[model samples]
Structures are given as structure tokens and as C-alpha cells.
Target: MKSEELTGNLHYQIFGLRSLYNLPDSVVKKFELHYASLPDSTIAKDTLLSVIINRKLKNSPYIFLRKKDGEVVTIYMENSQYQQFTKFKYKELIDNKQEVCIKLKAEKLMGRYYKCISVTSVKIKKGQTLGKQGKFLLYEYE
Candidate 1:
């Protein structure tokens, strides 16, 4: 498949919550110290603060720290799945000269943080004929 040819919408979700426990021991120790340094407060306030911090930290787009490591990783929806979208039905849309642009939300892995990223658009070649077959594109962000 040509690099510029985008077959369908990209669907991705962040997995930051899962990585909290996966951090190195040293990182965990640092987090513990930071947690304990917070000011003393009533139980409700403390719980609220903890919840807010946890959500903020986990929702940050810097949690995908692991590399592919030669393993097949499936981050977004499969090609078969994407092909099901009517707008991306290759045979009809491409044949009719319609342009397909899909915006996808993704996550970037930075050290121990997961950052949110976006795939703005994937465009198939103009005037290029498309068949029922679809292609996949893997994107990486810094």
C-alpha cells in the first residue's frame, strides 16, 4: 500500500491507568514521597485531592512507555474493523471521487507519562482507484 493512502478511521484509547503500577521501583518510590508531601486535610478533602491527582496524571498523554519490542501491538481498531465504516467503504467512496479524512485520538508514550496525540487526516491518493481491500498505517509521535 502507498504510504499516503489512508483506508479508514483511526480509533485509539489511552492506557495510562494500567501503567501506573508498571513504573520502575524508583519511580514508584518518588511518587510515594510526592503523595505524602501533600498538606494535611480532612478525609473528604484528601480523598478528593487524591482522586483529582490520579485522574489528571493518568489522563495525561504520556503513559505509553513500552516499545514494540518486535511484538505485534494492536493499538487502534483493526483494518477489518475500520473497513466497516460506510464513509471508508473503499469501493464506493474512492470510486465516486469522494475524499476521506479521519481524525483519530492517540496516545504518546513518554518515559512514564502518556500524552494525547491526534491523527489529523489520512487521505488516499486523489483519483486513485480503490477496491474492497483496505490498508493500515502505523503512526508514532514524539
Candidate 2:
């Protein structure tokens, strides 16, 4: 299995959202102060924006199979279950191709206090090369 991370301007949204998702307890506490002033409906969202992209991996650390409504499932018994769920969700659209490219974006409209915005995914076509944010690395078997 070979895996790599995508880090570029296009992925900034992913990076930002993940940063918010993994915020420290102390930071979250501070945000809670601001959160208190928000309306009741704003607090009910619970910070989860949405599932932008969902897909599986054929040769990487995770595997892909569709769930309800063709949603990708990462919990392939053959693959490790400890994989961390993150902001970007890449698809497994190619089986014989070398690699795939995934693009994502998010949008959140609450009050001025909070927002989580993002896009979805796109698999790189065969013979196509990586775009600005695409990266390739050898993934080690876990």
C-alpha cells in the first residue's frame, strides 16, 4: 500500500476544517464562550458540517465499497479500522491506474459566529498527472 497527503492552496479548506475539528480542549473552551451568545439553533448543529466526499481506496491503507446511497465505506476488514477520519474524502474510482486526485470544498452558513465550508471529491483520470495540491508517497503496510 502506498499513500501520500495532499497539501496545497486547494486543500486549505481541508486543512482549516481539520484544524477546527482537532482543536485543543482549551481552545474549544474559549470558543464555547462565544458560542453561548449564539441562538439555540446554531448550537444544535454540533460542529459537524457534512460529508463532503465519500469513497474507498483500492491499493491504499483503506478499501472502498459503497454503502447506502453509494456512500463509500472505509471500514474494510482487510484494511485497518484505526484509520483516522479526516476532512477530505477521496474516492477509489480507478483500479488499474497509478493514482487518483481528490478535490473537496465546504460551505457553512450559520450566524457570523461559526462556519465550516468545503467541496467534494474527484478521481484523477488515467494517464493524468497530479495537480497543484496532489502528492504521492509510498504507504507502509500497517
Candidate 3:
């Protein structure tokens, strides 16, 4: 039946209940533990990282995060809208010999690599030009 017909259907609800009841106990226990901590796990997935540009790779859309305690994180901007925005600001900061701190929400793409989702804040020592770059840094998703 169509999803519209399934709404408030007693038979559909019973079928779903039967399916769950037939599931293996091991699978049910795993589901319980995994879903029980969803709220906590979700919060850590989108981490807010404050980092400066280590250096921009030659002819690449990735920027490596500065090493901290020998750990280097790659920032992937290839598919993100703020690619140019990040590069421009990074160049400005480097030229002025100023510290650049960017707060962004990112998720891991691979080993020691992260895909920048949205930039929350960018702080350059003497930057004021970013205010005119539109809302390229801000992004909201459902």
C-alpha cells in the first residue's frame, strides 16, 4: 500500500511491531545502546575547531591546519562555498604577519582530514574587509 494509506493503519502498526519482535536479541541490544546516546554522539560529530592556515597546497583546494603536538589536520574546501573566502582571508593574514583564528563547524572526511561545513567566525588581527563579503561564512541547515 501507499505511504498515505499506511497512516494510522492498525495492520501496518502491527506488522512493524512483529518485525521488531522478530529481530535478534543481539541486534536489539546494539540498537538500544547506539540510539540511547544519540544526543551526546551527535554533538561531537560537528566539532567547532579554531585553527589557522598552515599553508595552502599548490593547485589544490585543501588547506592544512597547523600542527599541534605533531598532529596535522587537513581542511577540505574543494566543495564548500567559502573556499575563496577562506583563501583570501588567509592570504591577508599571512601578508600582515597577523594571527588568524577561524571558528568553524567541521566533520572528519578521512584520516586527519576534515571537511569545513560552515565558518562561524573569522578573526584577523586587523581585518575589516570580511564584513563586506556577504554572508559567505554563515550557513544554516535542517
Best by TM-score: 3
By TM-score, how accurate is candidate 3?
A: 0.35
- Residue 89 lDDT, candidate 1, scale 0-100: 42
lDDT of 3 at 83: 47
TM-score, one value per model: 0.23, 0.26, 0.35
Best-first order by TM-score: 3, 2, 1
Model 3 CA lDDT for position 79: 37
**In model 2, which regions exceed 4 Å deviation?**
1-14, 40-142
> lDDT per model, in order?
0.36, 0.29, 0.38
Model 1 C-alpha lDDT per residue in residues 1-72, reported as the tens digit of each score: 111212242222232233333356788688668777766563354443354354454222221112224121
TM-score of model 1 relative to the true fold?
A: 0.23
Of the candidates numbered 1 and 3, which has the greater TM-score value? Answer: 3
Pairs in steric clash, model 3: none
Per-residue C-alpha lDDT of model 2 across residues 1-142, encoded as one tens digit per residue: 2222221111111112222233467786776566566676764343422221111111223222222242332222122231322322333212343343443222222221111122234343463222224354322112
Q: Residue 84 of model 2: what lDDT?
A: 28
Local error of candidate 2 at residue 88 (angstroms): 12
By summed lDDT, the worst window of 10 consecutive residues in model 1 runs over 59-68
Q: In angstroms, how far off is 17's CA in candidate 3?
A: 52
**Ranked candidates (lDDT, high to low):** 3, 1, 2
